[model samples]
Target: MEKKTYIQAFCTIENNKIVLNGETVFESENTGFADFSKKAYQHFEIGYPKFFKMDNLSKLAFLGSELLLKAQNPNDENNTALLFANKSSSLDTDVKYQNSISDKENYFPSPAVFVYTLANICLGEISIRHQLKSENSFFIFDAFNAAFMADYANILIETQKAKNVLCGWTEFFGEDYKAFLYLVGNEGAIENTKQNLEILYNK
Candidate 1:
C-alpha cells in the first residue's frame, strides 16, 4: 500500500488580509505591505527582530509560515522540507535594488536589500526560524502549478526524504502580493491531491 499525505494546515495572505485555516485572522484594508506586515507581526506578537530586517517577499512568506508551523509544529524540524514557488521570483526586490545602483551619480547599493534578490531567501528565513535543515527549493513558474507541487511534495514524503513538506506559492511584487502555504504530512483532513490543492489555492 502506498503511503498517503494530507494538508494539515494552510495560511493565505493577500489583499491586505491574513487568513489561516479558513478564518480571517488579521487584516488591514488601508495599509500597504510594510504597515500591514508590521501590524500583523505585532498582532501575532512575533518577537523576532530579524523579521524587520527581511525584505518584503521574505516577510510575506514568514507571516504565512508562522501560522502553520506554530499551530502544529511537526516536532521533526530536521526533515521538514520547504518547497515554495512564485511568479515574480524576487523581481520585486530586484527592481528596488536596481533603482539603488542605477544612478551612477548616487551609486548606492545596499547589502541588506541585495540579500533578498533571490526568491529562495524566504525559505532560508523560515528554515532558520524553524531550525529546518532538510531539503528546500524555490520554483519560478508563470502560474501556480498545483499538479507539480503536489507531485513533488508527495515524492519527498513517500521517499522519506522529508517527513513533512511545507509547500505553497508566495508571490510578491510591488503593491501586488499573495501567499498560500500548507503543510503536507501523513495526517490531515484534506488529502494531498492536485485538485484539492487547486481548490485550496483558489479558495
Candidate 2:
C-alpha cells in the first residue's frame, strides 16, 4: 500500500497580513509590500541578513516559506522539493532594473538588481537558507494552477524523488502581492489534494 500524502502546514500573506495555519501571526497598517515584509521579518525574529537584499518577489516567497518551514521543522532537508509559481515572473524587479538603465545620462545597471530579474531567485534563496538541494522548479501561468502543483508534487513523492514538497504561489507586482505556501508530506491533518490546495490558497 502506498502512503498517502498530506499537507502538514501552510502560510498565507496578503494585504499586509500574515496567516500561518489559518491563524494570523502578523498584521500591519503598512500597505507597502516592502514595509510589510520587513515588519514580518522583524516579528518572526528572522536573522537572515540576505533577506534585506532580496527583491519584493523573493521577500514575499521567503517570508511565506519561513512561516511554513518553522512550523513543520522537517528533518530530511535533502529530501524536500521546492515547487513555486507566479504570474508576474519577476516583472517587478525587471522594471526596476530597466529603469536603472533607462536613463542614458545615468546609464547604470545594478548587478544587485539585475540578479533578481529571474523569478526563480526566490527558490534559490529559500533553498540556500534551508540547505535544500532536492528537486525544484518554478512555473508561470495565467493564474494559480492548484491542480498542476498538487499533481506534480504528488508525482515526485510517489516516485521517491522527494519525501516532502514545499510548494506555493507567490505573486508580487507594484503595490499588489500575495503568497500562499504549503508543506506536503506523508502525514498531516489535511490530505494533499487539488481541492484542499485551492481552498487553502483562496483562504
CA lDDT for candidate 2: 0.90
Clashes of 2: 0
**Model 1 deviation from the true structure expressed as Cα RMSD, one decimal place:** 1.2
Winning model by lDDT: 1
TM-score of each: 0.97, 0.96
Model 2 per-residue lDDT tens digits across residues 1-203: 25568998898999999988899989999758878888889999999999999999999999988887776555766789999999999999999999999899999998999999999999999999988999999999988898898888888899999999999899999988888999998888999888998899898
Query: Residue 73 deviation, candidate 2, in Å?
Result: 3.7
Model 2 alpha-carbon drift over 4 Å, by segment: 1-3
Lowest-sum lDDT 10-residue window in model 2: 69-78
lDDT of 1 by residue, 1-203 (tens): 27779999998899988889899999886678999999999999999999999999999999998988887655766789999999999999999999999999998999989989988999999999998998999999999999999999999999999999999799999889999999999898999999999998999
TM-score of 2: 0.96
